[model samples]
Target: MHWRQKVDYWLETLGDEDPLKIDLLKNLSNEKLMEDSFYKDLAFGTGGIRSVMGPGSNRLNVYTVRKSALGLAQYILDQDDDAKTRGVVIAYDSRHLSQEFALEAAKTIGRQGVQVYLFDELRPTPLLSFAVRHLNAYAGIIITASHNPPAYNGIKMYGQDGAQLPPAAVDSMVGYLEQIESELLIEAADEKQLKKSGLLRYIGEKVDLAYIQALRTIQLDKKAQPKDLYIVFTALHGTATKPVKKAFSALGFNDVIFVKEQSFPDGNFSTVKSPNPEDAAAFDMAIQYGKESNSDILLATDPDADRLGVAVKNDLNEYVLLTGNQMGAILIQYMLEQKKLAGNLPEDGCIIKTIVTTELASAIATNYGIKTIDTLTGFKFIAEKINEFKQFNSHTFLFGYEESYGFLIGDFVRDKDAIQAAVFISEAAAYYKNQGKSLYKILTGLFEKFGYYKEETRSIMLEGKNGAEQIERIMTSFRDEPPGTINSIPVIKIEDYFKRESLDTVTGEKAEINLPKSDVLKYKLEDGSSICIRPSGTEPKCKFYFAVKGKTAESANERLSELVKAVFNSTCDLALHSI
Candidate 1:
């Protein structure tokens, strides 16, 4: 059937009582809108489903949410009777319809006779992950879209291990999801009766307290005083306000100011242009708060609170937001320093990072005799390695982080924990302040000790069907005819993750890449610069990652500029005709 037929089927089959009916009726004449809405079933990646919330096959409405829940229920049942008995933990952020969606999933699973433990209120996504492990549940689901704009919302699936579902599991779930014949006709169990049958339970402060206790264990220096380190924090209108506040206060950080305007759980995220901490614009209000309070540092977490963004005072006393790579490098140094001092630095420990993340983190780990492992760009891959380490005893897991602000520590939670990061960052800040030094000085010291390393990212957002096709074209063009040189620097080798092989541009030699296949391409420049390009895993954008190391920061920045222009200019040339 054509895309038009899909839209027509939805229009005809939808009940008059369905809320999506009116929206579909009003947009019928908008051919482009209809096409985009019905062009495909929303792409369900390994991270689970995310898309704009509206009334279409591609939109995330109650019917679509029910479809996903029904599929999950079937997948859970297929595992074993014990799997169904172990149940799923459900939580939601502050997004519009988040609670509604959560309840819908719970009801759907309950109808299938699977146990459900739903959060009593909005909570950070990390808490959802923790609940799965803490309760020994079979699976977990959190209703969130992370840092996306207000118009979007999603559901993320986690496995029994408390990590996002691995690729094979996702593939199975997708198979189950594809077999559903009618999303609208599916019925959910009555919430009241689900409770009476003991199939549904609500979780609250008890779990929160347990998670905080687990967090406290990761505090490297109990004697480190945070009283002198004034800090500013903002949840950016998501779900971190309650727990982060509790963690900070519990740790004795008394002189902290919460950004009042953005602390509320508003789905609109009215205080900023975008909710993402990676975007510097989100820090404007936090910066204002930092300046007024003369704060030493600023911290912001996304809605689900799995990712953290930090800003600190530079030499000029202007607050500067640290990139994910910069913060990761700092944490690596600080964690190792404290571990070595305490004499618990394991001789066989390892640090895990994504392929696109900075090698500076690896350099810092190497200095401590800790091996660094590189995986594809996702926290699940990092979690996979954590599981592997435990199984094989190959190496002790020390830390795991990706370049996109996602981090994991303590292993209490399988995914990123901004709460943990906020605590450890506070400890690091206070530890340095006690020595009469600032975090800025420590960052510079790292650069001085391990050469100047810098990295930058550029992305292009292509929305709707045409935009997605254009992204494929751009990727294919780069893969088929690899760039010989980027900005007058020779392309020494090309790593094609999809092909699972590396080609030496000069020698015409091919070597196998051991990692799983992904649609990613990386180039090694002769001048010690690196360039990687891949489509965003969770968004409709193509991202370019550039990294360069130099004797000084100025040289690194200049070299980075040239490499970025070379890639950006070339990509634009490819998109000009299609776009």
Candidate 2:
């Protein structure tokens, strides 16, 4: 159907009581806006649907939420007999309509006679993953946009293992979603009716208490983590405020300061320009709080609280934000050290990171007598590795991370847990302080031991359908007309994940990659630097990852700049900047 026809159909079918129906009528004259809204169905790919909240088939609303839940319910019923009674857990963050969307999903699933475990209030995404396993639910859903602007909201679907749905599962669910025609026509059972029928149950503190009990096992240091170390934390007006407070209080951290302005569950995220912890701007309030309180470290979690951002005080007494790569390297060394000291460092243990992450982490792992494994980008892949190792009893999954700030240390939660990361970093800060060294100094020490590694991630925003096509063309160009050299540096090897093959440019040899196919390209330079390019799975953007290593910090930073500029000059004429 044409985009205009889809808009007209929505206008015809939706009830007047619906807010989106009213919005459609009010904006009938705005063709550009209408075109963008009705151009296509909101994609249920890479977990679930995420988009601007509005009155179109392409936007996120009550109807889309119901439609997506309907798909999950049918998939559960059809895929496994046990999944029917196993039920699904529903949770939401602090975004606008998050709670409403959660309820919509619960009602939709309950209407299908599937039990639904809905949280009583907003919670972090990681908790939703834990609640699924805790309740033995068939699947989980979280209403959040995870660091996106206030105008957007999304649904992330999780499998029974508490990880995001793998591609095969996502494909099965999409088949069901595609069979449904009109989003406005999908039906949801009445909330009161579902509650009366015993298909709807509210879950809160019971699960929270269980999760906290599990958190106790994640503590690395059994002894005093330090009474003198101070911390400043900000939830960025999301769901982590209460949990973080509870975590710090439980960990015996009395010197911690929560950033008051950004600590509450404000959906708008009023105190910051962006909710993403990767953005240094989001740490402004936390830094102010840190300096005022003379804190040792500053931590910020995104809206959903699955990814963590950390800043440490340097000798200059200024709070410096650590990139995802930097923090990942720091955590690898710290966790392994504590485990070794405790005499529980598994010989078969292995740390996992995405191929785009820095090699410094691998070096750190080697220093501690552990091996590192690389997977395709995204935490779901890491989660898959966790499951694979447990099933085969091959390797102990110590930790997993991606350069985008997502990390997981314990298998208690299948996905990344910012709460766990915050606790772990706090312990590291105290351990270092006892030795009269700052966290920044420890990071520098790692640089000296291993090599100085620097990394930068940049994205080019491409919106709308046309932008998506452009992204595809750009990716295709790289695969077809490959760059033999970047900045006069020889491209010694190319790993094309989509083809599931790696090529040695000099030797003219190829090797198979034993991982799922993906639209990613990794180019290895002769100088030991690497570059990776992939389209963002969740957003209409293409991301570029650059990494460089040197004996000194100055050399690493300089080479990094030259490589980034050279990559752009040597390839497509696309603008890229640090996101």
Clashes of 2: 0
Ten residues in a row with the worst lDDT in model 2? 570-579
RMSD of 1: 1.3
lDDT of 2 by residue, 121-184 (tens): 9999999999989999999999999998999999999999999998888889889999987777
Residue 388, candidate 1: Cα error in Å is: 0.3
What is the per-residue lDDT of model 1 for residues 387-445, given as tens digits with 9 covering 90 to 100?
Answer: 99999999999999988898887898999889989888889999989998888888899
Query: Model 2: runs farther than 4 Å from truth?
Result: 569-579
Highest TM-score scorer = 1
Q: Estimated TM-score per prediction?
A: 0.98, 0.97
Give the lDDT of residue 278 in candidate 1.
96
The clash tally of candidate 1 reads: 0
In terms of lDDT, model 1 sits at: 0.91
